[model samples]
Target: MQWYLCALTALLLATGCKKTTCECPPKTDDPKMEYTELNDKAVGFNSSYSLDLNKDGEADFSFSTLLVGDPVLRRDYRQYYIVSKFYTNCLVNGNEETPVLQKGDKIGSLPPEGFHWYNASHVVIAQKIIEENGTSWSGNWKQVAHAYQPVSILKGDKTYYGWIELSFDMQSEKIILHRAAVAKDPNVEVKAGG
Candidate 1:
């Protein structure tokens, strides 16, 4: 009786067993590039606009790419080393050194009402039309460049989570930059300059 009971249990267990398989996505060998710093070191600024000081519905920075960098996203793309701007009063230390703007550097105070564009310790007003006759591209998104305010230091991690958006408009011939609210670990700052 005992032997029969043991044999029956063994048979039932064998029939009820099912093979387990693991499904894992394939890992690519491609490297993940780190973001570079955007201080005076790894960045460059160049202004091409001619001033239309009268503001007759015209821009001052005109007819050229103000600043270009390695495409913002790529598997091999490295982080920016320094925050560089092509517009005047964009760089903190006049673009003379690397990492011109450091962490904890107090940017200027916000304006009383509308858009308050600024840099560290600078209340930036538009000096020239960075681009009057701007470039045009097609699609739902277009690219154009114009001078409005100076510029400010923006963290890189702030970019991925939709903190900053850079787009262009072909129909309007304008490059649009929108700054969004940031919520991230302050310790994970990207030092730009590479």
Candidate 2:
């Protein structure tokens, strides 16, 4: 009975996606590509966007917002971050923050000198910290708009690549997720937004 239920669930999920084949840039269409249409979804305080790169039930990564207050310090801190999940990594370096990438960038192995795959859990996109002295802003996504970031998923010894298109604004403290795509083929470099 358990085996029958598992097969049924898998069949439903396989047909749940409305679109499968990707018709991206000319000659870049990949039938094995999986795309998720978020359509400018805004994730802010108390809200988060869970991304399942391979249509699996588990979350590969997620974008979230957190706000904490310290009465003793008389300040509040609001932060935005992308949390890397199990076997998932973000493109980062010694700086610890993922760099804002341009669209169509190649995400492959042995990335540039200062760039490599790292499991950057709780990667700050932006942070608004208010102290008694004053309010200060920090992080690479403070003023970013329509930026691309690389995400890698490790399965066994193979790695799959993907990208997410998003925007973050300090004024609204919101992270807008436009879309995400993943290449089903392992070790294949996937172009951002393609």
Candidate 3:
């Protein structure tokens, strides 16, 4: 009985001392994802691009810019003018709408009441040219107007943050997207002027 008891105790000790492997998998660093700089020209009066900031198969962000037009003139006189607008994939529609202002709306200005209920999910950030002809416009030139302000966008259940800077050169007939920053997830916040 003494021998059996000693053997049982040894077996229990050996079993307890055995190395156990953890079931959890090893953690790896996430892929290095960063914003991409884009320099594109507007097809007509507008240009759009779908961005996948996280390298995910699906597009996470979309940006569109339209030249603001005068309601009275019914046209955009400034060839280089652009108002950068950011949107999620959900808000974009296949149908076309007039880019100019309608009744009760102001020219070269967003709706005073803010985005309509249908467009509540969309966010707008304006960038005007700060300098022109090697001198500050003194708020005169709308072509280069730009404000590097951060705007929050709510799409579906997630909220994203980003900033955009738009510059157009009439001489070159090009619209330059100087900076764009979009968050991959709601928890992560993007800095301004990205």
Candidate 4:
């Protein structure tokens, strides 16, 4: 009886101490709304625009694309990078005049209250440039540069957290964004779809 009691206590303790793990469902798109695609016409040197990513007819974020020349080369040629800015008002229109970053402008400073920029080192997503007959395509979702990272967007009073991926095609001059809304509180249960 003594041995049986000891065995039962050990089994109970083992079972009680087992850790419970939560499995989150994979991200899926909402069939009702389509993903936004910005083509070459919409992007250019010093071009800026407000994007309605979730298709709610409201601009959730804004972006500025800049073309900078190589310092050492000092040629007329330039490379492109994007600066992303968040908006508190969903209906905020883009600034009339798009601002361009100069060669000496600071590129690594923390973004202002509502803005963030991506440079060579800290790209938000993997980028692929597909070319066909001298035309470029930058909206491929299959090619992910790096694993998804957590990002939070504050709209009004609530802050939404999620994973985001961005892709740009240099030749085609397009930007593709993929986002999945996660739980507001990371520790809480995450719903299946964003």
lDDT of model 2 at residue 35? 88
Best by lDDT: 2
Model 3 error, position 141 (Å): 7.9
TM agreement with the true structure for every prediction: 0.24, 0.77, 0.37, 0.34
The order by descending TM-score is 2, 3, 4, 1
Off by over 4 Å in 2: 1-32, 68-75
In candidate 3, the residue pairs with backbone N, CA or C atoms under 3 Å apart (3 or more residues apart, or in different chains) clash, namely: 127-145, 127-146, 128-144, 128-145, 128-146, 129-144, 129-145
Q: Which parts of model 3 have CA positions greater than 4 angstroms off?
A: 1-33, 39-155, 187-189
After superposing candidate 1 on the true structure, give the runs of residues whose Cα lies further than 4 Å from its correct spot. Answer: 1-163, 174-183, 190-194
Q: How far is candidate 1 from the true structure (C-alpha RMSD, Å)?
A: 17.2
Best by TM-score: 2
- Model 2 scores a TM of 0.77
lDDT by residue (47-81, candidate 2, tens digit) is 88898878878999999888889898899988888
Q: Candidate 4 on 1-194: residue-level lDDT in tens?
A: 99999999999999899888868876753222223334423334445555554456765455445443445644332223333344321111122111222222221123223444321222212133323333222222223332232233455655443333344445454444433333334222222122
Reference-based TM-score, model 3: 0.37
Off by over 4 Å in 4: 1-46, 52-60, 70-72, 76-79, 86-150, 155-158, 178-194
108, model 4: CA deviation in Å? 23
The clash number for model 2 is 0
Give Cα distance to truth, residue 65, candidate 2, Å: 2.1
